[model samples]
Target: MNISAIDLTIFVFYCLLIMFVGLFVSRTKKGTEKDSKDYFLAGRGLAWWAIGASIIASNISAEQFVGMSGSGYAIGLAMATYEWIAALGLIIVAKFFIPIFLEKKIFTMPQFLEERFDKRVKTVMAIFWLAVFIFINLTSILYLGALTIEKIMGFPMIFGIIGLAIFAGIYSIYGGLKAVALTDVIQVIFLVGGGLITTYIALNLLGEGDGAIQGFSNLYTKTQDKFHLILDKSHPGYKDLPGISVIIGGLWVANLYYWGCNQYIIQRALAAKSVEEAQKGMIFAGFIKLFIPLLVVIPGIAAFALEAPLSKSDEAYPWLLSNLLPVGVKGVAFAALTAAIVSSLASMMNSISTIFTLDIYKPYLRKKANETELVRTGRWASFVSLIIAIAIAPLLSGLDQAFQYIQEFTGFISPGALSIFLAGFFYKRATANGALLAAIGSFVFSGLLKYIQPELPWMDRMGIVFIFCCLTIVISALIEKKGVSEKSINITFDLFKTTKSFNIAACIIIIILAAFYTIWW
Candidate 1:
């Protein structure tokens, strides 16, 4: 784990460069009032490239670098279903979800809900999202990031956690979404390039200096049994991925909720210059997602082929970096890991601030708050959420499988919330009462099933929960005598002229995804 002078210098420069870029972008607009739109949504001026880069940077964190690699070490290629399936999810979101959101001019996901339903629905969902961002998303990122830093750089866990918080907050707290998105352009480059380097070196080692091809062949030959795209009950990891359910079952529930409905992921698209720009950005993100498995998952398979002597699967990533990567390259890899960690932290912090300030604070606490007051409140919210997350992050150390831990726990609300959004989008008779009932009922039902039917696969449980939520909403609507005459947001399916570029890119992504599944199936 010893870092050479060159590597340490490179890492320091990377950190300094990121901070400089973020700060520079924050100060770019001189005459503008740091209003709610500018601070929360980047003044709604982000281009397609910025939106696309930010989405990938924010999405890839310790969860993918540390957690998914850990899962790859344990469960093999089956762990990558999350990434591969997400490409398709992005396509769906770009086509169906983003257009609606952009048309409504909503800042937060809860705002969209409120527009379609009522203020009560918005408040309830905002509170739920705020809690998830702080507790589940932020805590997991910090915990796993710290775990990686502790193993590779030899820092104590607490220092690593606090260090990451400060590093991300320095640029994000003041600049808000604009700074986060701008800086993400730099982060995505470091993260992906560094991740690719780590994968290449690890594979090269496995190939005995025969190159990536030989390494990949060696990897497949050694761990052929572990490369299944789908898992049956006979496989030990079946409970985690399950069989065809990964494709047509609960995986869709998770993917749609995440790529389509999650505030942080969708926030970028919402901020795009136009609906067309947003769609293009999402399609661009879908393409980036196609290569994520190579950068994040393959190294774990290489580690397994090498039979790394680690007590925990999460340790596989750090073990590889600590042992295999050379001096200067090691620093770059470390920086990439740090970039992945910090970018997500920044994104989540911005999202937490956005939801709380716009959705909760401005609406209920300060009904007549001005632009300056709202921006001030948002900055405060970001700091407060960071403090809470820092306090709770260390507690997640008890969880062994951090990747699956995140997926399973978040499943509690995803299906229910997704049901509400879907019903609101497609059904005019979907009453506020029905949406609320579905949200609350599915949450409670998901929890009860977790306790009583823990034997069921979590993904399958999600599929069941989504259907139940939909049914509940439909029945509630019928009982309340809410007819199709109730006018919801007017969704013009004919508004967008689907661009040929988007169509071609989407086809390429689908073909690549299909090829992977077909080869591995």
Candidate 2:
């Protein structure tokens, strides 16, 4: 794990470049300052490419590089269902979700709740999101990112955690989403390039230097059990994936919630210059997602094939980097890992500030806060949130599979949140009271199910909870004798339409995914 001088140089240069880009984009002309729109939504100016790159950049992090790789090591390619299914999820979000969001002109997810339901629901969900973002999302990212740094550089975990927090906060806290999104374009380049290099090297080593293709062939031949797309009951990892549930059941709830309803993720699409731009960006992300397993999962399977010595499954990616990469290439791969970590941290921080300032502070604490004051408050919010996450991040050090831990805990909120949103979008009779019940019941139902039926697969439990929440909304509305709330969104077919190119790209993605599952099934 000893770092060579050349690798250290490349990593340093990459950090400086990212910081410079972030700061440059954040710069404002004299007498002109960033308003809430500029700071929170990137001034609603992001083009399709930036939106696409930023979405994936913010999405893939140490969770995938470290945690998901760990899952790959333990469960094999079955771990890829999260990424592959997410491709279809992005398309669904693009077609069904983004249009409503853009049409409503909402800044944060909480604002959408307020417009569709009531302030009570908005406030409750906003607080819930804040807690989850800081405690679960940000903390996990920092912990896993630091874990990678510790494995690759042989540094103490605390040093890696603090260093990552500082690097992310330096530009992101000051610049906001504009800086984060713009700089993410470069981050995506490094992330993809470096990740691919690591995969290529690992595969080459597995193939005994025959090349990546032979490496992949050798990997598949030797590790055939790892290639299954669906895991049955007898498989040790079936509980984690739960065979058919991944395709037809609770995974849909997870994907839709994470991609469509999550503030940090949908914020990129919200910032797009147009709805068309947003949809196109989603389409682009879908294509990129199809290849993510190659970068993240294949390396872990390659590690299994090569017999990487590791204390835990999460060490797979780091083991590859430490053992296989040449000096110059190692620097690039490290930069890639750092890029994934910091970009996601920056995105999460920006979203945290956006939700707190716009949804909480402006509405309640400072009813008449102006643009300058709100922007300043957002910056402060970002700083505080990062500090909190950095402090608690070390607690996650004991997790065996951080990815599954994230999914299980986050599921507590996702079922409720997704139920509320889906009801609000399509069910005219959905009342604020009903939405509120679903919001609260989501956590209660999930917890009860987990406690009472500990053997139930987590995905199946989520599906059951989602159904109960949906029913709660329905029964509450029935009891209230409401037909259609005044706040119900007027649906129009035109809002879901996409460009020819977007449609074609989406079709290509679907075809490719179908071929993959067919071959692997």
Candidate 3:
């Protein structure tokens, strides 16, 4: 697949615009120990619109563009679980977790752990989060985006990668979290708008071959099995991805941990001005989540209808672009893809740098460091992490499943962090020692099962491991009941106050969209 002069020019233009935005933000964006708070957490003062769009941009990456579309090719509509499950999880986070985070004014989730539990819990989480974010999450997105260019446009892998790393690092280094957040908003508009256009074109292509009715029938045939929510042992990996278990036992725990507890992902909400604003942002992201299938998954099915069996595993999305998009629209779509890749790269790089600077550097290196010094340190950290991520990116280029690899490595924290945080907040009797132990136990259990069983239901493996970790913490805390803080018995629930009308309205909208998703066609 040759990248035409026009597509290459368009892609380059988007990258330049991203750099321009980063440079623009760096001069205006504040930074210091006083501003360090702003650099890392967007001054803790983002409006809902910015927060909402940034959430979409930061969250959707080349993984979804390439990996998710690949899943659509294999599993059909079943892959939509990653997007939809988050809807339930975000509401839970918006209602339950955001309040606690904002109420405490926690700089990071690990900070919340230290506040509620102990320093040991915080330190352990920091190490786990940093490792997963750097090696697994950041590396995979960089790899997949680079690989997409390598396969689709005939560029060397290193070119797609260094270009991404240097570009993302430059802005992220200078502009900090505010730059990352604002850039994310712009990226998401490209991501969603470009994705919808692709979806529209692919579906329109279906009408050409067999006409609309026959095309719809062919589309159903390609994806019909994916709609069934039960395990079917007959097909390959069917057992690996049974819809009901995939959603219930599997995705539920994973999404809760991701959307609810992961610091890098949830910091967009943490950056919001008020709890109400944060809730609005998460709910808005939830609404956007519902539309993702229409963009990513539906297009993959449409590809099956028109251009069947896209070769070179990752070619699913690119093949559709070659066949579906018109010339000028291809340029816009390419920009959108660039925007998604760069935005995610910037978000991950920014978060990793934040953790290193605040969690590891300042406390251990120079406790008396001022805001100005910390800001400089963060810049250095971002540069170094980008280098490491760029190096690791090529390694993931040929992986069979990007999302699965990401989830596997990410389990090091999500299950463990969720358990520790829940225990700290709800189970007052939970001991810091027990929480730390739970973190270690959860990682070992999940990792061992995933590696050994390989064939065991991934979700149940994760769910059972999560339960084991929760039980360990709960029982240990109960045994240490004598040490529990009696005054902490109350929720100190000030964090949870939100306009009743907003939540009710959000729920009503969800029901309406969900009904349409189910009943339409």
Ranking by lDDT: 2, 1, 3
Candidate 3 regions exceeding 4 Å error are 29-34, 209-218, 229-235, 307-312, 486-489, 492-495, 512-521
Q: Please provide, for model 2 over 380-416, each residue's C-alpha lDDT reduced to its tens digit, 9 standing for 90 to 100.
A: 9999998899899999888889999999999999999
Alpha-carbon lDDT, every model = 0.91, 0.94, 0.77
**Positional deviation of 107 in candidate 3, in angstroms?**
0.8
Greater TM-score among 2 and 3 belongs to 2
lDDT tens digits, residues 1-521, model 1?
46788898999999999999999888855676688899989999999999999999999999999988988998999988899999999999998998888888989899888888998888888888888889999999999999998988888899999999999999999999999999999999999999999999988887887898898988999999889999878998899999999999999999999999999899999899999999999898898998999988888888888889988888889888899999899999999999999999999999999999888888888999999999898889999998998899999888777999999989988999999999999888999988899889878889888889989999999999999999998998899996873448676757545789998998999898889999999
Candidate 2, after superposition: displacement of residue 163 in Å?
Answer: 0.4
Clash number for each model: 0, 0, 5
lDDT of 3 by residue, 177-287 (tens): 889988787788888998888876676566566655565566776567655434466756464464456655766777888888887788888889998999998888888
Cα distance off (Å), candidate 3, residue 460: 1.0
Residue pairs with backbone overlap in model 3: 32-35, 32-36, 32-371, 33-371, 250-459
- For model 1, the stretches where C-alpha displacement exceeds 4 angstroms are 28-32, 485-487
After best superposition, candidate 1 residue 168: deviation in angstroms? 0.2
TM-score of each: 0.98, 0.99, 0.93
Least accurate 10 contiguous residues by lDDT in model 2: 203-212
What does candidate 3 score on TM?
A: 0.93
Candidate 2 segments whose C-alpha is farther than 4 A from its true place: none
